[model samples]
Target: MPEYRAPLADFEFLLHDWLNVSEHYAQIGKDDIDADLVNEIITQGARFAESEVAPINQIGDQQGCTLKDGKVTTAEGFPQAYQSYIENGWNAMLGSEEYGGQELPYSVAIPVHEMLVSANVSWRLVCGLTESAVLALEKHGSDELKETYLPNLISGEWTGTMNLTEPQAGSDLSLLTSKAEANDDGSYKISGTKIFISGGDHEWTDNIIHLVLARLPDAPAGVKGISLFLVPKMLPDANGEFTIENDLSVGSIEHKMGLHGCPTCVMNFDGAKGWLIGAPHSGLACMFTMMNDARFQVGLQGTGIAEASYQGALTYAKERLQSRAPQGVQQPDEKADAIIHLPDVRRMLLTQKALTEGSRALGLLYAKQVDIVRFGTEEEQAKAESIVAYLTPITKSFFTDMGQEVSQHGVQIFGGHGYIQEWGMEQLIRDSRITQLYEGTNGIQALDLISRKLVRDGGRMLQNTAALFSDMINAIQNEADKNMALEIQQQWLAGSESLMSGDAFDTASRAYDYMQFCAYSLLAICWLSMKDRAAQTGNDQLASSKAKTCDFYIKRLYPRALMHKAALGDSGEDLAALSLEDF
Candidate 1:
């Protein structure tokens, strides 16, 4: 079985040295969020993940989830591990103080989340969705709804899920046929069959809260008519006891490519009693709150998986012996040299390291923006909101794409052994694949980046992005680092201009490339920040490692941005010219 060790030192460097989150927390009046408290939380979270959750990974993957008589049973050790997770207060890290939550900043929760996902992403899915649900209910739920649901959800006594997809509706939620009829006591009758619902039904919790999106009886057309509903698997009585069963059932759980431990169910809601969340006909808007949170967590999922894959590959490379090194047989006592001595192997390992660490930095930066949006002043909130909006798609799409690529590299580095199941390299590839497809597919995320975030405001978000790059560039004293940052920013600016000037067809065709370009550029900014911060702190070992990684990223990986930029100019005429008959 593969092993996972939390990158505690990296977390410390990013939180304290690079981002200076402690000062930011103090500025936001969160004096309780010092380095010591943050360290304690991360330490305990890491211990729990490494010890409890990770042991069940292979067991879950092998046994998978069993659905018998509509109730889903998780793999061995899952329930016990989850019980420990809840007992440790891990689920309440980001919840509100008004409920039974710790009320920590989002940034503070991010490292803990990364560790859990890295430990075992399959199990982490349950916790991730519940956190998103807690955020959505806290932001948009009515006073009564909050009082009823927030406590248990935050306390991890019950879990939550987001139900948006149906047979006819996937990305185009407007086609959803799920219907909601008004009921007499201000509740609505929700009837819909939702597919691909993670944590839809699990034995770990007594009840599950589902936030379903459906249209009202007399409603407008398309997404405009949809409204959010709070539907629970078991309804609570006036005394807050879940004794009454609701009209919802788990029709079946999907036998998926990966994440077998987490049950992805086909849920059927037959006139389930539910209450309105936000305003009528504002379902999409309300759900966006949860969707945005889920999207960011998915990005963390990618980073976590990449870290796991890299660790496996690096361990195998050092232990596995191959042919002698090109220069000479350094290990004269042994029959052959380790693969880590090979240049090609070094390239793969460094690529994994550079991208994984870069993704971590970028994600943490975004998490800080989320923290500011929640706790900062009006001016800070406005700026952070724009940054968050602009970076959401990039973070989600880019990080996952990197995760898939890095995992593939891990498999390749292991040679034939990577294809085998026991080493766990193949599982990483299978697990990381879905991150690109779900939470709005990477292609959809790219289009969203181009259409909504970039083009909608006449490049205003790009300008905000450029200002961020400029700040880091100015702070860097090294000429090479400064020049590399400038190059990435310049290319990104030119690509944004190309996207803005293109017609609809051209923009749609090149949006994916543009999003990739933006991701590389943003990662460059992150690398530069890490390099500069490491040097400033007099941490020679970290500074040297970061500098070498930054150099590798610039010399090798950064050129991909240029290629994506060139691809942007293609107009995709050849793609459109191909007829359906060509197939």
Candidate 2:
């Protein structure tokens, strides 16, 4: 089985040294949440993930979830591991305190989540989806709904799922035909078949809260007509006891290419009992609350898988014997030296390390923005919201794309063994594949970044992001660090200018490249910040690692931005010129 050890030291460095999260906590009136408390939480979370969750990862993949007689059964050890996860209070880390949660900042919760995801992403999906549902309910659900459902969901006694897509509607929520009819009892009867629903049907929890999007009677046409509904697998009686089964059934679990441990179901809702979340004709808006949260978590999924794959590849490269070193025989006693001595092997390993660690830092930086949005003052919140909006698509797309590449690198380092199932490298590729496709495909993420985030705002958010990069650059005292930061920022700005100047079709054609350019730039800023901060702490080992990784990123990976920038000039005319029947 592929091994996973949580990157606890890196987590501590990012939170305490790099980001200075303790100061943010105090500024937000969380005076009691000191460094010790944060460290303890991270420590325990790591222990649980490493000990309980990691052991089940391979077995879970081997024995994927099964559906029998309309019921879904998860892999062996999943339920027990989840129970331990709940008992350990990991699920409620970010929930509201009023609902019996820890209410920890996203900055803290995210690292712990990365650990869980790295240990076992398929199992982590159940918890991650539930957290997104909690956020949606906390923000948009009515008071009655919150009082009725939030406690159980937060406590992990109940689980949750987000159902947005139907058979005909994938990314286009406007074409959805799901129906929600209002009843005299002030609830609605929801009837729809939601496909590709992650954690849709599982045995970890008795009642699964489904935040579904469906159109109401007499509602307006298109997205504005959709309404968000809180539908559960079991109905609650007058006493608020969930004893009666709702009119919902699992059509079947998807036989997916990866993430087999997670049960992605074809859910059939036959007039299931549900309550309106937000006002009618505002379902898309309400669901966005969940979708955005899910998007960020999906980004973490990418980072987690990348970390896992990197660790596996690095271990294999060190122990596996291959051709002798180019200069001479480093190991005279053996037939050949370890593959790690090879220059090409080192190149792949360093690329994986730089990209994975850079993605991790970028994710944490994004999480800090989320914390500011939630707890900062009004002006701070406004600025942070803009940063959050700008970074969302980049985080989701870039991290997942990095995860896919890193996993592939792991397979390559393993050679033929990577393709075989026994080495466990192939599973990482299979599992990371979906991160690019779901939570909006990486392509859709690019379009959203260019059209909605970059273009619609008239470049105000881009300026705000630039200001942030400038702050990081100015803080670095070292000339080399400052130079690296400046180079990436210049590349990013040039790409942005190219994107802003073109016509709609031309800009849209280059959106993916522009997003990639922005991603690399943001990651560079993150790397520079980590290196500068580590130097200040006088931690030679940490500082050296950070500085070397940052150097590798700038010299090696940042050139990809140049390629993407050049592609931005294409205007997509060639793409549009091709006729449908040309093939």
> lDDT: which candidate is best?
1
Q: For residues 1-583, write the lDDT of model 2, one tens digit per residue.
A: 6778889899999888887888989988787899999999999888998999988898889999999998899999999999988988888989999999988899889989999989999999989999999999999999999998999999999999999989999988899999999999999999989999999998898999999999898988889899999998988778978999999999999999999999999999999999999888988888888888899999899999999999999999999999899978988999999999998998999999999989988888889889888888999889889989998999999999999999999999999999999888899889999999898999999999998888878787888878877887888888977887887788787678656766778778888888888887788788887888888888899989988988888789888877877787777898789899974
The lDDT values for all models are 0.91, 0.90
Which clashing pairs does model 1 show? Answer: none
Q: In model 1, which runs have C-alpha deviations exceeding 4 angstroms?
A: none
State, as a TM-score between 0 and 1, how close model 2 is to the true structure.
0.98
Which tens-of-lDDT digit does each residue in 1-583 have in candidate 1? 6789999999999999988888989998898789999999899988998999888898888999888987899999999998998988899988999898988999899999998898899999999999999989999999999999999999999999999999889999999999999998999999989999999998999999999999998899999999999999898788978989999999998999999888999999999999999999999999999999999999999999999999999999999999999989978889999999999999999999999999999999899889989999999888888889999999999999999999999999999999999998899899999999999999999999998898877887778767866887787777877887787778788878767776777778888999988898788878987887798888899999998998899889988887888888898797799899996
Each candidate structure's count of clashing pairs: 0, 0
Model 2's alpha-carbon lDDT is 0.90
Model 1: per-residue Cα lDDT at residue 214: 93
